[model samples]
Target: MKSMTGYGRSSFLCENVEVSVEVSSVNKRNLETVVSLPRDWQALEREILTLTKEVVSRGRINFSVKARVDKAERPEASWDEKRLRDDLEQLRIFAEAEGIPYHPDASLLCRLASGQKFEQSLPDPTKMTEGLKQAAQEALKAMIQTRIEEGKHLEADIKARNAEITCLVNELEVSSEGISALWREKLLERLRQAELELDAEDERVLREVALFAERCDVSEELTRLRSHGELMNQILEEDGPVGRKLEFALQEISRELNTVASKSPSTEVKRLVIEARAECEKIREQALNVE
Candidate 1:
């Protein structure tokens, strides 16, 4: 088991270059990675996304990579000879046509060329592919461990709540037995008030009572609930991304509880069903963070 919520950060500094990576995420139904790398190094976004996917299965992750290379390691602004030559030639022709002095100094030409600086840096390829990847790996390791620890705590809490719900289910079962007796008495009394004398063991009376009993019987629902509970426990014990499965199980449990509540005639049983629903709801909320 692992949680979808966690944070990890790592930094690698070599010579005059520094690289740092931060990875964090929140619960999500799908894997979504938002990677923010240095603008000059935007080409590395694919690598960053791949790295994040290797560690996370489902979540909206915010991954950011920051790198600082010293001035000595950065590529210097260079002039575009073709463009500069064309501009100079055009200027000379215009000056000649207007009889103006057009002798340009190196400073003016350099200023015009500075606007065309290369949109890239001069960092060592080995350091980026190897060092940065290693740093990202280390950060991901820490994050996975943190998520595991968080999942353990979530499991403990869910187990405690599940136990409470089980106890409530048991109480409801015990309380349900009285509904049948009360139902029979009510039927007999109503018949007496109408001046109809029917034996309790008569074929007509037995068939009618049995029909009512079947409507109010929650035995099957209780059995299914137990089975669903066992399946839920098994899911929490397994590994890998199980949040979607757990969510489906929760919906099934809620449906079963609804059926049980609607069929139960006893007020006490219905009340207990509501309480169980409440406890299970808490577990469902916590499950949103699972992965």
Candidate 2:
């Protein structure tokens, strides 16, 4: 099992450029991804989303990238002194031939040098695909590691709650065993209170008790609850993205518990049913975060 909540980041430096990738995720009913990259790097979005889907099957995942060039190492920042001098010399010759003043002013030198300065062109994003891929992979691996670790804790909690629910169901079954006898006694007392003499062993009294016992029978509901519990255990033992299965099992268990609670007349049985339902709810909450 793996959790749906985690975060990771990695940085890659190469050729005087550094790229960083960060991946984070939160629980969701299905898989979703949001990618953030430089405008020129939009082409890489498909690759990133594909990689994320390879590892994550359920979550709202976010991927973001940041890149920067080392200013001191950039080729564009280098001065081409020879080119500047040649252009200035040609300009001076042109001025003399035209009978204009040949002397170059400080403003002219500054303007010519400025004109010779190289335009800062950013490196092509397509060329950095390998570096970006490496960073994204590392970040994704780290995120999955965290998710696995967190999943251990979640598994422990859910199993503990499941055990508690099972114990409560067992208690409810025990408490309901004598419910028919209790109902028979109550009915006899009611007849006496109304001043109507009815034998405890009367055919009509036995028939009424049998009908009442049939109505309060919770054996089927308890059997279904146990079956759901077994299904939950099977799901937990299996690998990968079992949240949906766990959720379904819990829902069925909840329904069975409700049915048991309604059929039983004993106060103790009702209390046990409530406790079991609470545990099921807690397990359901934990299952929501499982992947």
**For model 1, what is the error of residue 24's alpha carbon versus the real structure, in angstroms, after optimal superposition?**
0.3
Q: What is the C-alpha lDDT profile of model 2 across 1-291, one tens digit per residue?
A: 899999999998856667789999999999999999875678889889888989899999999997776657556455568877887889888988998987778898777654443223345777878888888999999999999999999988998898888888888889989899999999999999999899999999999999999999999998888888888888888988899999999989999999998999888998998889889988988998999
Show model 1 residue runs off by greater than 4 Å.
69-127
**Model 2 CA deviation exceeding 4 Å by range:** 73-121
lDDT of 1 at 92: 95
Q: Which ten-residue region of model 2 has the weakest summed lDDT?
A: 114-123
Tens digit of per-residue lDDT, candidate 1, span 30-110: 999898875456666777778878878998988778766666766676667898888789989999999999889988787
lDDT of 1: 0.82
Candidate lDDT values, in order: 0.82, 0.86
How close is every model to the real structure, measured as TM-score? Answer: 0.81, 0.83
